[model samples]
Target: MNFVGYYRLPPVRGVFFSPAQEERLLLLGCQEVFSDRCLAGGVVRSGLDRALTALEPGGVLAVPSLHALAGAMVDLLDVVRRLRALNLDLVVVQPPIDTRSDAGFFEACQILAT
Candidate 1:
């Protein structure tokens, strides 16, 4: 088989604060399986649980970029931040290094490369 033929597992998403907002995020989200409080309920925890269940193990959770970091952030990096804030374990892709010190960036890249 050609190396190009390979595909990766899917990403999952969740919403808990607002319905319309959540739906919109899902529709516009770069990842698969978006959950909004409108469709899932009013609980953010429930939305998170649902999204987690739908996610494949070791898959990444994607989210919108923060207003502050928008210009310097990537779609995948934003998701990783949200996941970390929510206390989820995910493989953060293309994470930003501006927040890091010079030593930190060097260490992180070394770890990432491995």
Candidate 2:
């Protein structure tokens, strides 16, 4: 199984992924990193699409935070559903969520429920 790192910069002016964030993902054993810079009022997430497509069943997707993954609750849920359908795991470094663990999985569900 591979651990792939993904990050996104909001439409604001900033770098793709901060050095420390990339370092953290690397420390967590991520083999590759994918990133996106959101365009103002844009809905396309080509980077996320590529990352998901690159992973096979049982692969892992690591991100710095939930907000970095998606902007809205519905979008987040859709991403979670896709991860489940693809048989992939998720690891969020900040706020520390790991769907691979029972407690973390429950926490994820709770977060989504709210």
Candidate 3:
């Protein structure tokens, strides 16, 4: 299975966090990295859109944290639902979530519920 890394950072604050996030994803075995540096309030997430569109059904999407993936919980839930529908897995670094195994999937669900 292929692994893709995605992250979103505020435009002016990404100088350090962006590279660190990329390196972490690389260490986690992600082959491709897609990033967005834009205002947090902006509705467009071109990088995330591209990553989702490019990843195949069996591929995985890795992100630093839930916050980096979405601006709000509603959006996060929507993305998670889409990922599930697409048969794509997700690996989150912070809070250590993985949807590849039964226990991990359970843990992810618990986290999402809170």
Candidate 4:
């Protein structure tokens, strides 16, 4: 479904996506605009750690792009770490990252160089 409705909505609360995340999510085709992955209507929560697991089940993920690539790495790492902890599958456009393989991490590190 086109995400026109979602992108148009004013952000609700907590850490909503940046414009980039909205674009990525639009490209990924989310059926609904999820504020965050909450459990029991906020009684329990996945936070970033468990939240990213949704990616494997067809959630399009996006990490913030800082002023520069180097700056962005920290943000990217946090995103990756969270996703990795959840064992979520991801598709990175710039530098390919496969947490399962050392080679992928090594290669991605090189590719991510600013």
* Best-matching candidate per TM-score: 2
TM-score of each: 0.30, 0.82, 0.80, 0.35
Per-prediction tally of clashes = 2, 0, 0, 0
Q: Rank the candidates by TM-score, best first.
A: 2, 3, 4, 1
Model 3 lDDT tens row, 1-114: 478999888768636347788998899998888887766457567788788888899889999988888777777877887787787889889988888854466356558867
| lDDT, residue 37, candidate 4 | 28
**Deviation from native of the Cα of residue 65 in model 2, angstroms:** 0.4
lDDT of 4 by residue, 58-107 (tens): 23343222221122365555544554455444443344432333436534
**Candidate 2 C-alpha lDDT tens digits along 37-57:** 888886477878888988889
Lowest-sum lDDT 10-residue window in model 1: 1-10
lDDT (10s digit) by residue, model 1, range 1-114:
000000111222542234443344355433544433322222233444556555554344433323211222353344345544544443212343322122353344335544
Off by over 4 Å in 3: 13-17, 103-114
lDDT accuracy of residue 53 in candidate 3: 82
Model 3 Cα shift for residue 59 (angstroms): 1.2
| Candidate 4 residue pairs in clash (backbone atoms < 3 Å) | none
Q: List the residue pairs that clash in candidate 3.
A: none
